[model samples]
Target: MAKKSGNAFDFGLFKRLVGYTNPYRFTFYFVGLAAVLLSIFAVARPYLLQQAIDTGFVPKNENLILEYVVLMLVVLFLEVIFQFLFIYFANWLGQEVIRDIRVKLFDHMMLFKKQYYDQSAVGRLVTRAVSDIETIASIFSEGLFMIFSDLLKMIVILGFMTYKSWQLTLIVLAILPLILYATRVFQKKMKTAFEEVRTQVSNLNSFVQERITGMKIVQLFTREETEYTNFRSINEKHKKGWVKTVWYNSIFFPIAEMSSSVTIGLIVWFGGLRAAEGDVITLGVVIAFIELSQMLFRPLRQIADKFNTLQMGMVAASRVFAILDTDARVENKGTIQLKNISGAIDFDEVRFSYLEGEEVLKGVSFSVNSGDTVAIVGATGAGKSTIINLLNRFYEIDSGTILIDDKDINTIDLKSLRSHIAVVLQDVFLFADTILNNITLNNPDITEQQVTEAAKEIKIHDFIMSLPDGYHYNVKERGAMLSSGQRQLISFLRAYVTNPEILVLDEATSSIDSHSEQLIQDATDKITEGRTSMVIAHRLATIKNADKIIVMDRGLIVEQGTHTELLEIDNGYYKNLYDVQFSTVTE
Candidate 1:
C-alpha cells in the first residue's frame, strides 16, 4: 500500500497522476484557459443583469437594454464554445495517459518472474489493468479541472456580491460556515465509502472471472447451486458498498439545496427591510444576490461530489502504481548471447526451493550429454519437474550452478537461453485463436510452410486436416473446442516447430488417450533422435528404452542406469516401481 499524505486525499499521489500530463502539457494549458474563461463568464452573467436592470431602467432607455442583452448573449455563446473545448480536450488527455500507462504496465508484467504469477490471481490483475485505470480518467474529465472551475466561480461571485451590497452579502456569509462544514463532513464520509466500493469491485471481478474459467469443474462436480450461493454472497457485499455511497449522496444534496433556498430567502427579506429604511440595498442588488447565491452554493455542493470523484480516482491510482513499483522481475545482467548450443547440460549440486526452508531440489546433481535421451521418474513431490523448471531459469536457484554447453546458464541472455529449449507440459494451454495463430504465436519468421512441415514430421498433419477448418480451425479459449488428446497433439506440434536444441516433456502424454499417447511417443522418438531430450514420465514403459534413467525419491537421485541394467539390481527402486505399475495395470 502507498503511504497516504492526508486523511482524505494523498497529495503525493495526486501529484504523480498529474505528472502523466507532462506529455500532454499543451492540453493542460487549454483546459486551464477554459476554466479561467468559464469562471469570468459565469460571474459576468449576474453582474450584467444587476447593472442592466439598475442603470437601463433609470432612464427608460430601450437602446441601453438592447445593448446589455446583446452583450449577455455574446458572452453566453463564447462560454458554450469554451465549455465544449474544455470537456473534449480533458477527456482526450485522460485517454492518452491511460493508453501509455496500460502499455507500460503490460511490458513490465511480461518480464516478471514466474513466482509472481504463481502467487497472484489473474482476475485481480485484470481489474487493475482495465476498470481501475478507467476510474483514474475521471480525475480529468469530471474531477480536478471541473472542481477548479467551480471553486473559481464561487470566489468571483462572492466578490461581486460583496461589492453590490455589504449588508445582503453578510446574510449569505452567515450561512457559509454551516454548509462548508456539512460539505467537509460529507467528503470525509465519501472517502471511506469510495474505498469500500473499489475493494468490492475487485472481489466481484476476481470471483466471476475464476468461476467462468473453472465452469467445467463446477458443472462436472455438480456444485452449481453451491457456487451460485457463493457468488450471491459476494455480489451482495458489492451492492451494499455502492448503496452506502448512494445513501450519503441522498443526505448531502438535499441539505445543500435547502441551505441555498434559505440563503436566497434571507437575501430577499434583508434587502427589502433596508430599502424600506431608505438604505442603499436596491431591488436590483437583491435579485443579483439571489443569482449569486445560487451560483456560489450550487458549486459548493458539486465540489463535494467532484471531491468524491477525485478520492475514488486516487484509490485506483494507488493500486496501479503498486504493480508498477513491484521489484518482481528477474535481473538479466548477462551480455553473452548464445550463437548455438551443443545441448549438453550439467547441474552441479543445484539447490532450489519454491518456499523458504522447504527445498524441492536438495543439492541434486545430474548431467545430460549431447543427443542423449534421459528420462527422470519419481513419485509425486519427488522433484521430477523441478529440474525442468530450473533448467529454463523459471525460478532462480539458491545455490550451486546450472550450465548449458559448459557456459553457466545465468551468463546467457535470458531470452536466448529459453529460445533454445522447448517445454510441453501436462496441462496444454491454447489461446482463443485459429490453430495456425496458436502454432506460430504470431512469430513473423515462423512461416506457414514451416509449421506444416513440422506437423508432417510429427504425423499429426493428417489429424489436423480432419478438423473442420484444418489448421485454420478456431480452438476457442484454452482449446475448449477440442478434446484433451487433440490439445496435446497441438502442443507437441508447437514444440516440434520450434526446432529447439533441447526438448523437455514434463508428463506431456500422461493425460491423453492411448491413441494420442502412441502418436506422441512416435513424435517424441523422431524429435529426440538427434536432439538432447529430457522426459519426466509417470508411465515407466514409455521411457523403458531411454539411454539413462534417473530415479528420484524425496528430492534425491537414488538410482541411475538403463532399463535392463536397473532391473538387474537386487530389489532395486526401479524394479519395485515398475513391478507395482504393471501389476496395477494387470489388476
Candidate 2:
C-alpha cells in the first residue's frame, strides 16, 4: 500500500530512471539534437509568412512573394524530417531501456526467498512486470522528450513575437497566469486519477487471474454465479477509475480552448486599434502574432497531457523500484562446493514454523545413513512433510542444525547442495511441453537419449511410447493430457535421470490408483537403489519393507524401529496405525 507522494515531479525517481538510458546515450543525444532542429524549423514558418506579407505581397512584388513562399516550403520539409527522426529515436530508446529493466526485474524475482512469494499476489507482481513497465515506456515515447521539444518551440515563438511588436506581446502575456494556474490544478487532479486507475487495474488482474487459474475448483463447487458477481464488482471499479480520467479531460480541454480563443480576439482588436492610428502596426505583424500565439499556447495545453504521462511513469517506476529494493532474497553466503555429497543427512534438534508462534517441527531430530532407506509415517499436519522441506533448505530452521556429510548444511553452496538431492511430491507438476523436454527440462547437457535411457531403466519407457507421439507428445498445461498414474511415472523418470545422491518421495503414491501405485512402487525401488532415500507416506502398506520406520505424532518421533520391532511394541503409535490400515485393507 504505497501512498501517493504530494510532489508532482520526483527528481530522485527521475534521476534513477534516467540512469537506465545511459546504455543508449548516443541515441538520446541524437534525439536532443533533433528536438533543437525541430524547434528552429517550427518558428521559421510563421516568420516566413510575415516576410511574404510585409515585404512581398503588400508591395505587389510577385517575384519576392514567390521567393518567400519557396523558402517556407523548404523549411516545412526540413521540419517534417526532424519530426520523424525525433519520434523514431525516442520510441527506440524507450523499448531498449524497458527490455533491460524487465530482465533485471525478473532476475531479481528469481532470487527472492519462498516466503516472499507466499505473501505476495501473483497478479500484482504480473502487473508490475508487464503493465507498469509498459506505462514507464510511455514516459519516453509520448511524455518527457515530447514535452521538452514543445517547451523549446514555445520559447522560440515567444522571442519572435516580442521582436515583432513588444506592445502586442505584452498584452498576450497578460492572460498567461490564468492558463498556467488552470493547467497546474488540472495536472494535480489528473495525477490522483491516474493512481486510482493503476490500482484498480492491478486488482482486476489479480481477481481475474486467480479465478481463471482456479476455474476447476469453481466449477466443482458450482460457484459460477457467486464468482461472476464478485468479478462484476471489481470490473465496475476499474471502469470508474478510467471514467474519472476522461471526466478530467472533458473539463480541462474546454478551458484551454476558451483561453486560446480569448488571446486571438485580443490580438485582433488591439492590433486593429493601433493600425487605424496610421501605419503603426501592419496587417502582416498582426497575422504573424496570431500564428505565434497558437504555437505558444498549443504546447502549453499539450504539456498538461504530457505531464500526466510523466507522472504515471514516475509512479510506476517507484513501484517497480520498491520490488528491486526488497532484501528478502535467500542468503547464499556458503563457499563450500560439494557437488557430489555422500548422502548422509543428520537433523540435530531441528525446529521450524511456517508462521510465528505456531511451531510445526518442535525440536525434532533424525539421522539417515548413506544408502539407507528411511520412512517417516505420521498423521496429517504432524510435521512429516516439513522434514523434507527443511532437508532441501526450502525454509530455514528456527533452531538447531541440519548437517549433510558431517558439514553444516548452511555452509554448502545452495546450488551444489540441492544438486545432489531430488524430490518427487504426491502432486507432481509437469510443464506444458513434450515428454522429452519436460523430462530433461531443456537442459542441453542432458541429451534426449539420456532421458530415454532413464525412462527405460525406470520401466516407464513402454508406457510413454504407447502415446501417439511417444516422447514428443505435448503434455499441455500441468500435464493434463496424462492420468494421475502417468504423471507419477513421469516424475519418477525425471528424478531418476538426475542421478541424485539423496532422493525424497513425499507421499508420491498417496493420490494414485492401485495400478498407478504399483507402477510408482516399482519405479521407486529402482530409483532409490544405492541412494539415501526418505519416504513420507500415509498409506502403511507402501513402506512395509523400509530399513527403518520413524512414527511421528504431534511433531515428535514417538516410535522408531523396524516394522516387526514396531509391531511388537504394546500400543505403540506405529503399531496402532499399522493395525488400522491393515484391517481396512483386509476388509
Candidate 3:
C-alpha cells in the first residue's frame, strides 16, 4: 500500500511527475508559447474599443471609427486561433504524459513481490491506476497551463490600465487585498477537502468492489440489509467529502462576486465625479478601466478553482509515487539459466512464516527424486500447502535451502525455474476469454491444435466439443459459466498443455463431484506419469497409489512411506487417518 503525504504541495513528488513529461517536451513548449500569445491577444479587444470611443467616434470621423472596428475584428480572429492552439496542445501534452505514467505504473506493479499484493486492496490500486491518474491529467488540461494564462492576462491588463490613468486603476483595485485574502483561505481549505474526497472515493470503491465480488456469500448468509446499511455509511462519507468542497465554494464565490461588483461601483462613481468636474477623465477611459478590472479580478476567482485542481493532482501524484518508490520487489540476481531441468527437489531444514513469530514450516526437510510422485497429507493448518508455495519460491524461506537437480533454487534464474513447473490450485482462476486462449494463455508458440491435442490425450476433448462454441467458447469471468468440475478439467488441460517437468496439484479434487473426481483422477494419472509431482489432498483415499506418502502434524512430518508401509505402522498418524477415512467410505 502506498503512503500518502500530508503536505498540500509535495515538491519532491511534483518534480518527479514533471520528469514524465520529458518525452513530450516539444508539445509542452509549444503549448506554453501559445499561452503567452493568448494573453497578449486577450487584451486587444478592450484597447480597440477605447481607441474607437476616444479618437474616432467622439470627433465624428467615420473613416477612423470604421478602421478601428476592422482592426478589432482582426484581433478577435487572432485571439480565437491562439486560444484553439492553447487548448489543443495543452490537452495533448496531458494525455501523452498520463499514458506514459500509466504504462510505467503497470510495469512496476508486475515486478512487485506477492507479499505487497497480499496486504494491498485491489480497488485502491485500481483507483490509483485509473481514477487518480485521470485526476492528475487535469493538472495540465485544466489547472497549470490555464493558471499561467490567467496570470499573464491579469498582468497585461494591469499594465494597460496603469498607463492610461494610474489613479483610476488604483480605485478599481481598492477591493483587491480582501479578495486575495479570501482566495488564500479558500485554497488552503479546498486542499484539505480534496484530499478527504480522494480518500473517501478510494474507500467507497474498495467497499463496493468487495461486496460485489462476494455477493454470493452475502446472499447465502442473508446479509442483504446488514451489507446495505454498511454501504450507506460509506456512501454518506463520500457525499460529505464533496459537500465540504461545495461549502467552501458557496462561501468564497459570493464574497468574490460582491468584491468585484463593489470595485466596479467605485470606479463608475469616482470617474463620473471627475467627468462632471469638467473632463478630468473621459467616458472611454472609465469604460476601459471597468473592462480591465474584470480582466484582473475574474482570474482571481478562476485561479482559486484551478488551484483546487492543482492540489488534487498533487495528492494523486504523491500516492502514485509511493507505489513507484516501493523497494519490496523480488530480487533475481542469479546468473544460472537452464532450458531443461531433471526435476529433483530437496528441501533441507527449511523454515518459514508468513507472519513473524508464527512459524508455518518449522525446520521441515523433504526430497523427491526425478519422476517420483509424492503425496503430502495433513490436517488443516498442518502446513501441507506451504510446501507448494515454498517450492515455487512464491515466498522465501526463513532459513535453510531449496534445491532443484542439485542446484540451489535461489541460484537459478527465476523465469527459467518457474518455466519448468506448473501449479493447479484448489481455486483455479480463469480469465474472461475464449477456452482456447485461456488454455494457451495467448502463447503464440502453443497453437489451438496443440491445446485440442492435449485435451484429447486427457480424454476431456469430447466434453469441450459438446459446448456451443467448443474451443472458442467464452468462459466468462472466473469461469462462472462452467461447473466446478468443468473448470478443474480446464485447469488440468491448461497444465498438461504446458508440459512442465514438475507439477503441483494442491487439493485440486477436494471440491468436485464424484463424476468430476473420476475424470480428474484419470487426467491426473496421465499428467503425472512422467513428471515430478507433488499432491496435497484432504481426501485420504486419493493418494493410495503415491510412490511416497508424507504425513504431517503441526508443521512436522510424523510419518513417511508408501500407503501400505504407513498403514502397517500401529496407531500412527497416517494409519489412524486411513482408518477414519476407510470407515467413512464404507458407511
Candidate 4:
C-alpha cells in the first residue's frame, strides 16, 4: 500500500504554486474578483424570486413582478459574462504558468549530473515534464477558483436564509454535520485512490515507453506473448485504481444528494406548516428557502469533489517541485575561460566511482602531451569510458585532480573546456533531420562550404554527394536511414568541422563492414594528423602506430609505451594482449 498525500490542503505548497502567478497578477486578481461577483450574483436569484412572489403575487402588482423578472434576467446575463471570464482567464493563467514552469524544469533537467540519470527513469521524467505539470494546470482552471466560488456562493446563500427565517435556517444547518463527515471520509478515501491512480499512470508510462523504445529487442527475442502478459497485468492494476475511485464516487454522491433532498423537504414541510398557521413564514418565504437550501447544500456537496481535484493538483505540484528542487548537477564555479590551450592532458592519480565504495578508477595516472596521439586499451569496465565522462565534466571525480596544459581542468570553465574538445563516440546518434543539419547540429556558424571542405578533407564528400538528396538527405531517427559506417562518417565530419584542439575517438571504427572500416580508418588518420588525440580501441591493429599506448586492467594502468617498445617486453600485459589479438586476426 503506497502512502497518499493528505491533509487535503497544504498552505505552504499553495503559496509556492501561487507564486508562479506573479507575472500574470492582473489575470489572477481579475479571476478572483469574478468569482466574488458570481457568488453575489448567484444569491441574487433566490432573493429576486422571493420578492417577485411576495410583492407581486400577494400585493397583485404586475409591474413589480415584471421589474423583478427583468432584474433576474440582467443578473443572469452578468453571471454568464463573469463565468466566461473566470473560466477563460483562469485557463490562460494556467497555460502561462505551466509554460514557464515546464521550461524551467527542462532547463534544470538538462543540467542534472550524469549520475542522477543513471538511477532515474526516462519515462518518469517525461511524466513530470508533461502530464504532471498539466495536472498542476487544473489547480487554476478547476480547483482553486471553482472551490472559492462554490464556498462563497454557499456563504451568501446561508446569510440570506438566516435573514429570511432563523427557524428554517436551523433545519438546513442540521444536516451540515452529516455532510461534513461524509465529505471527510470521501476525501480520505479518494485521496488514496487517486494516489494509486497516479502511481499506476507513472508505471504504465514507464513500461510503455521502455517497451516501445526497445521493440526491436522484444521481437528479436520473440517476447511478444510475454510482454503482452506483463502489459495486461499493469493495465489491470491501472483499471483497478480507477474503479476504486468510481466506487467511492458512487457511494458518496448519492449520500450527499439525499442529504440535500432531506434538508429541502424539511424546509418545505416546516415553513409550509408555519405559514398555514399565520406565522412569519409566508408562502414566498417557503419557496425562497427551498431554493436557498439547494444553493447552499449543493455547493457543500460539490466543494468536497472540487477539493479532491485541488488535492490531486497539489500532489502533482509536489512532484513537479521535487524535480525543480533536485540539485544534482556538476557545479560550474570556475571563472577562468580556456582558450589557445596546448591540449596537454595529465591525470594525476585520479580516483573515481559510480557508486560509493566501488571504485572504477583507482589512483589512475597518465599523461598525453600536446600534438600526440595516445591509445588506451583494456577489457570492458576498465574505467575507459569513465575517463572520457570525467574529462567532459559529466561527473565529478571522487578524489585527485586532472590538469590541462598545467592548469587544473576543474578550474577551467566547463563550457569552454568542452567546446575545445570534440569527442566522437562509438555509438553515433543522429537526429531525424537533413544530413547537413545533423552534421552542423543547426549551428549557423558552420556553413555549407565549411562542411563541404571538412567532408572533402575526411574523403567522405563523395559518399555524401552519392546520397539521394546529397547533404540535404534526411537520415531519419538515430540515422536509421544510413548504414553504421556511413553514420560514423557523418560523426567524423561533425567532429572535424568543429576543429577542436583535442579529439577523443571512442572505438568509433568498431562493428562496421570492411569497406566502411577502411573509409573511417582513412578519415581517422586524416583528422588526428595535427590534433592531440586520445583513441580508445579493442582493435589493437588500429592503434599499433599510435605515438604511445596505455594498457589497463581492472582499474589500474599496467603498462605504458609505444607499440614496438611494449611488444619487446617479455610476458608484459600489452605483449600478451597483442599476441592473443594478432593471432585471432590471423586466424
Candidate 5:
C-alpha cells in the first residue's frame, strides 16, 4: 500500500502516454465529431415532440404531422448510426494505444539491470503491466464515451430548458448543487475502497505464487495445515475488501436513484401547475421539460457509475509510472572499443558493497595472466561471487577498477564487454524448448553445426543422440525433464558455444554426479585452454589443476599459490581444505 504522492501524474508522463495515441488521433477526432452530432440530434428529438403536440396534433393537420414524424425518424436513425461509429472508433483507438504502452513497458523492463528486478516484486510488476493497463484501456474504451456523451447531452438539455422556460429551469437546477455534493462524497469513499481491494489483490497474488513454487517444501516439512491457514488469511482479506466495495456501491446507487426520483417528481408537479395557470408554460413545453430533466439526470447516474473505474485507473497509472521512473544503477558511459582481446584480467583496488554501510569486498586486487586458470576459494560469503559480478559488470564496484586487456572495464561498452565473457552457472535454467534451442539459448544466429560441435566438444553429443529426439528433445522449465547431470552438461555446452575470451565457472560442477563432473572437467579444460578463467570452487577436486589458487577470508586474499605449493604449507587454509577433501575421498 505505497502512497502515490505529488507529481506522480505529472504532465511529462501524460504527454509520453498520449504520444502513443498519435497514430490514432484522426479516428478519435471522428469519434468526437460523432459525439457532438449525436448530442445535437438527441436534443432535437424532445423539441420535435413538443412541436408536434402544440401545433400539428392540436390542429389535426395530417400532412404536417406525417412530415414531422418522418423527419424525427430520420434524425433518430442518424443518431443511432453516428453513436455506433463513435463507439467503434473509440474502442479501436483505445486498444491500439494500450498495446503500444504494454510493448514499451515490457521492452524497458527487459533493458533494466538485475538490481531493479531484485528490488521490485513480481506481483506488483505484473499488476501494473496487466491490471493497470486494463484500467487505462477502459478509460479510452467506454469511459471516454460516457463522459463525453453524458456531459454533452446534459449541456444541450440544460441550455434548451433555459431558453424555453427560464423560471422553471432555475427551480429545477436548485437541486443540482445537492447532486454534485453527493457525487463528490460517494466518489471519495469509492476510491478508498477500490484502493484497498487493489492492495488485497496483490497480496493474494504473491501468496499463490510463493506457495505454488514451494509446494514440495511445504509438503516435506509437514506445513500443509500451516500453509492452508496462511492462504485462507490472504483470501479472507481479499474477500472482505471486495465486500466493502460492494457495500459502498450498494448504498451509493440507491441514494443516486432516490435523489433522481425526487428531482423528477418535483419537476413534473411544478411544471403541471404552471401550465394549468396559463403562464409561460404550455402543454408541449411541459412535456419537453420533463424529457430534458430525465436527460440531465441520466448523465448523473452515469457519472456515479464511472467514478469507480476512474479511481481504479488513477491507482493503476500511479503503479505504471513508478516502474517507468526506475533509475539504472549500472550505467555504461565508456566509449572505448576492443574488437580483439588477449584474455588478461586485472582487479586494481576493487571494493564493493550490496548496500550502504556494509562492504563485501575491500581493496581486492588480483591479476590473471593471458590464458591462465585461477581458482578463488573461501568459506561462504567471502565475496567470491562478487568478484565475478564485477568482472561481468552485473553490479558496479563501489570503488577502484577492473581491467580487461589493459583497458579499464568501466571504459569499455558494457554489451561488448559482456559479449566476450562466458558464464557456466551451477544452477541451470533451460527454457521449455527444443534441446537445440536450449543449447543455443534461442539465439537464431547460432548455426546448427556450431551447436553440434559445441555439444560434441563438451562430450554430451553422444548422450544426446541416445535420447528419443536427440537435439529436438524438449527441455521442461529449468530443465526439469533432464537429470541434474544432463542439465549441467547442457549448460557447459551453452557456455562453450559462445567461445568467450574469459570464462567464469561459478561452482559449475557443484551439484553434478561424478561421471558428469568428469565430462565437464574435460570440457572445462578445452574451453579454458586459451581463455583467462576464474573458478569459484567449493569442491577442491574441481580446481586442483589450476595454475594459481587464491584463498580468501573476510574480503582479503589470505593465501595465494599453486595447489601443490599451498598444500606444502602446514597451517594454511588451502592446505586444510585440501586435507579435508582428501580425507573425505579416502573415507
Candidate 6:
C-alpha cells in the first residue's frame, strides 16, 4: 500500500511516469539524442547570425554570406528531420505504454471483489481506462518531449552565452532566480485549477452515463424535468470548472511572456551601454545575447504549461495507484486439479458476511451428491445466490470448508474449479457481436457445428434462423435487439456449451413469459439430467422435481426436504411461498 503523500501536490508522479519508460529504453535514448541535436541546432543559429554580422557583412564577403545562409538552411532542415523522428518514436512508445497500463487496469479491476463494483460507478472506471490513459499518453508523447527539449535548449544556450562572454552572462542571469520563483507560484495555482476540471469532468461523465443507461426508468417515473434540472446543475458546475481552468491558463502564459520580454529588454539596455562605452562587446555578440535570451525564456514558458499538465497526470496516477494497490477480497489458493471426477458438493459449517456485523449466511451446511438436483428456495436477500456464489468461489467464505467429491475446494486450482461449473444469472449480458460469436465468446476452437447444436438444444436456433443473417446476426450492445426471453435462452446455450460438471441457475426463468419459461424449464431439465445442479428460484414450480429442496429465511435454512415434506410442514416461510405458487398452479 502506498502511504498518502502529505502534500496535495504529488512530486512523486514524475517518478512513476519515468518508470513507464523502462520498456522503451532504446526510444528514450534516440529521443534524447534528437533533443540534443535539436538544441544544438538552435544555439548554432545564433552563432551563425553572429558570424554573418561580424565577418560576412563587415568584410563584404559574398561567399561567406552565401555559405552561412546555406548552412543555416541545412541546420534548419536537419532539426525538422530530427524532430519528426523523435515525435514518431516517442508517440509509438507512449501508445504502447498506455496500452499496457489499460490492460493492467482491466485485469486489476477484475481481481477486485464484487463489493468494489457494488460501490463504484461504471463511468469512473471508464474514465480511468480512457481519459486517464489519454492524459498519461499525452504526458509521454508531448509533455516529456517538450520538457527534455526545453531543458536541453536552456542549458545549452546558457552555457554558450557564459563561455562567449562571462560579464554579459552574469548580468542576464540576475533575473533568472526571480523568474524561477514566479514559475513555481504560477504552477501551484494552475495545477489546482486543472485538477478541479478533471474531477468535474469525471462526475459529469458518471451522471450522463447513468442517466442514459437508465433512461427508461427516468421516463417511466415521469422525472424528465427533474433529470433535466439535475443535468443543468452538473453542467453549470462543469462550466465553472472549465472557466477556472481557462482563467489560470490565461494568466500563466501572459506572465511568462511578460517575464521573458522584460529580461530581454534589460539585457539589451545593459549590453548596448557596455558596447557604447568601448567595452569590446561586438554588435555580433550583442545580437547573439539577444537571441539567446529569447531562446532561454521560451523553455521557461513551456515548463509553466507542462507543470499544469503534470498536475492532471499526477491526480490520475494517484487514482490508478489506488486501484492497483487495493487488496482483492477473493483469495484463490487452489492449485490442485480435480479432473474427470464425480461432482459431489458439500458446504460444511459455512459462515459468510458481506458487511462486518451482518452475517448473510451462518452455520449453513448441506451435501449434494453427484447428478443430484438441489433447489434452494428463499425470499429475496435470504442468501440463496450467495450459496451458489460460494460454490463457484466467487467470494471466499469467512469460515468453514466447501468440499467437492470429499476434496476441499481450496486444494483445487481456481481455473479448474470454475471450468467445471456453469452459472446462468437472472440478468444476462451478451457482447455486441454476431449471435454465433456471442454464444461462443470468441472461443475459436469451438466449431460452428457445436455452436449451432448448443443453440438448437436451447430452442433458440429457430429464432436465430429467422433473422436475416441467422447465426451471423449481430447482437446490439447488451443484446438490445433481442427480447429478455431470447437473451436468456442465448445465455443458457452459452452456459450449456461449456458442458460444465455443475450448473447453477439463479432465478434464471423468473422474468420470462409462460411459454418461454416452459422452454427454459425443458432446457434445464435436459441439461441437468446427469450433472450436479443447484437451482435458486422463487417459483416453486421450477424446483418441484428437485431431489431435495432447501428453504431459507433470514439467512438460515428454515425447512429442508422434498417439496411435499416442506408443504406438509405448513410453516409460515416455506408454506406461504408454496401456497402462493401452488394456488396459481391449481387456478
CA-lDDT, candidates in order: 0.88, 0.88, 0.87, 0.89, 0.80, 0.81
After superposition, candidate 5 runs with Cα above 4 Å error: 1-19, 277-279
Give candidate 4's error at residue 30 in angstroms. 0.9
Number of the top lDDT candidate = 4
In order of appearance, the predictions have TM-scores of 0.96, 0.96, 0.96, 0.96, 0.93, 0.95
Structure candidate 4, residue pairs in collision: none
lDDT of 6 by residue, 201-268 (tens): 78988999999989999999999999999999989988998798688768767876777778778778
Q: Write the per-residue lDDT of candidate 2 for residues 230-331, one digit (tens) a residue.
A: 999999999998998899888888888888899999999999788677566888888888988988889988999999898888778888988998987777
Model 6 alpha-carbon miss at residue 341, Å = 2.9
Q: lDDT of candidate 3?
A: 0.87
Q: What ranges in model 2 sit over 4 Å off? A: 1-3, 276-280
Question: Candidate 5's C-alpha lDDT?
Answer: 0.80
Measured on C-alpha atoms, candidate 4 has an lDDT of: 0.89
**Comparing 2 and 4 on lDDT, the stronger one:** 4
Residue range 96-178, candidate 1, lDDT tens digits: 98888888888999889899999998888999999989998999988999999999889888887888888888899999998
lDDT of 4 by residue, 94-192 (tens): 899899999999999998999999999889889989998999898898889888899889888888888999999999889988988999888888877
Candidate 6 Cα outliers beyond 4 Å, as residue runs:
1-11, 570-572
How far is 72's C-alpha from truth in model 1 (Å)?
1.2
TM-score of decoy 3: 0.96
Model 2 TM-score, all chains together: 0.96
Q: 1 or 5: which has the higher lDDT?
A: 1
